[model samples]
Target: MSFSRIKRACAVALFCLTLSATQINAQQKRTKGCLTECQPRIGIVSAFGGEAEVLLAETINKQEYVINGNLYTTGILRGNHVVIVLTGISIENATMVTQLTIDHFNIHHLLLSGIAGGVNPDYKVGDVLIPRRWAQPLEVYWSANSNVPAPCGTPRDLSCLGLKLSRFTSQPNSDYQIPTPNGPVGTGLFMRDTFVRNNSNFPNGEFKFDYAADPEMYAVAQTIAPKLDRCGPKNPSLCVAVQPRIRRGGRGISGPAFLANPDYRRYVFKTIRAVSVDMETTAFAHVAYANEIPFIAFRSLSDLAGGDDFTDVSALFASGLAESNSSRVTLGFLEAWSQKYPE
Candidate 1:
């Protein structure tokens, strides 16, 4: 062959080889259910449309991935790589999507931001809370009969069940003793379940309930709390009468039911000592705990959870304010976290 022809042939061969290798690597990533470069990134989740919209607005260099009809966006938020997703509006959806995200991405930290019902009397609408721990109030084994006698030496109070109906009862010894600065405080109506799973950090067994948020993330949130804007200027009509504030170090509870009764709200507050109630946080917390990932949540109060006479006002007016406040805090948290742990 002529020298010029030989050189051209060699260049063509090299191009074909590079193209084949690139195609093979792309195929492999798809088959394994991962991105080509699964960079260690923070995972951000929201359960409401408003919450997700707010976060998506701040995302830059966005890339979309559609898996099983669920949309996930990866981008830079607050100068950190993050994968943002919406978990829909229930515990089942939250658990499924959170697990899916962890399975497909190299999630270094998880942060959930959403609106919640105010469970504590001290928290007003639009206030944001970052609870140190989250629990599922609906995971209960109810007693078979209403006639079951209360434990001896204990008061015959149905309020301990944390439900309005007196017929429902929890096991006598199901209370969880949570350690506090003051002392050990007993809360909840069911003992935490121990699950044996290979993928979990605790292979032998570990409690699935009362999942605690990462202390470092909680500390970062506390630092950003004062800097956040608590009052709504965009929607002044929906602004809370009292100036909203960021509250840290409280218990957050989740259940399937939307609590709209005064009795139930009071019961949850008194029994669980919870500041916020939502439908999704506990499931997200559980999955994060099982995967041994550092996780935190910022929940803004949309309503009193049945404390106010205008029950419909929350969904009609206060949701936007709550979402706005939570999104603001979430952005602040992300900025602080990225600065503390720069790439």
Candidate 2:
């Protein structure tokens, strides 16, 4: 073969190999984003604009990405590489975005910050709560009024044929289920226990309705509890009516509905023994538990669930300090975590 012809053939072979390799690298980047090797971020999630605004403003080296229509921004906040996701305002949105962030980025930990209703009567608005565990009270089943004979042990003394019935659909799980507080019984409403298995081959997942925040991460929050800001968002001099404080390690619950019923609020506090209740924390906690990532949350009381006396629904929004308090506590947690964990 002539030297010129051989040289031309060699160049063509090299060009094709290089192009094929480039395509493979590009596809890999698109799919996993190099899971472990990619920039590791502490995932911080908020449920709405009011909750996310301050934290998003302070994030440096900001870069934005949209996944499955959810907006996520990656940047360094409080000296930690973090990805912030605005999860709209519901359980489904929170679940989808949290998992999406885990799938697309190297998320080492997950944190949820937002304003929530004070379920614990002792707590008032502007108090930041760090729940040690979370539950989903909204995962429920509405029972039908049963005219059927009350089960074997339901008591024949209480007017046998006319007695209201309360029984578990799933015996084992129901044993641990949160009972309807001060119930009208069969008029219907039951908190059904759900199951979960992070990464198991067990045929039946474990019956679980509560997920705990990572203790190690919770400690960071506890450390900074005393240092959190208690000032107003607009005017620092104008503080909350009750001095804002941070309380760590209690329970929190999430459901689709905004908790505004005083009776139910009392029930939640009594039954789940929750300090705060909102729409996103439990969803985020559940996802983190499944992913085996460290998770924690900061929720500030906006109002007294249904105890607030307001004339207009639209006018009854949380004071700016409520969200600011939450965001500030979250930032302090992240900064403390960055030091404790060191990437």
Best candidate according to lDDT: 1
lDDT of each residue in 227-299, candidate 2, tens digit only = 5445565656545555667877778989999888887777667666878888888888888877778888888
The TM-score between candidate 2 and the true structure equals 0.75
For each candidate, the alpha-carbon lDDT, in order, equals 0.74, 0.72
Question: Candidate 2: what lDDT?
Answer: 0.72
Q: Which runs in model 1 stand beyond 4 Å of their true positions?
A: 1-37, 145-203, 226-234, 311-319
Candidate 1: Cα lDDT at 325: 76
Candidate 2 stretches with Cα past 4 Å from truth are 1-37, 145-186, 201-203, 226-231, 235-239, 310-319
Q: What is the TM-score of each candidate against the true structure?
A: 0.74, 0.75
Q: Please, what are the lDDT tens digits per residue for candidate 1 over residues 1-343?
A: 9999999999999999999999999886554424423877898989877878888999999999887778999999999999999999888999999988888877889999998888888777667899999987666534433333343434343335432222223434334344559965544444233242435444455435478899899888778854444445455554456667788887898878888877667766776687889999988988887777899998878777877555434433443666677888999999998899887
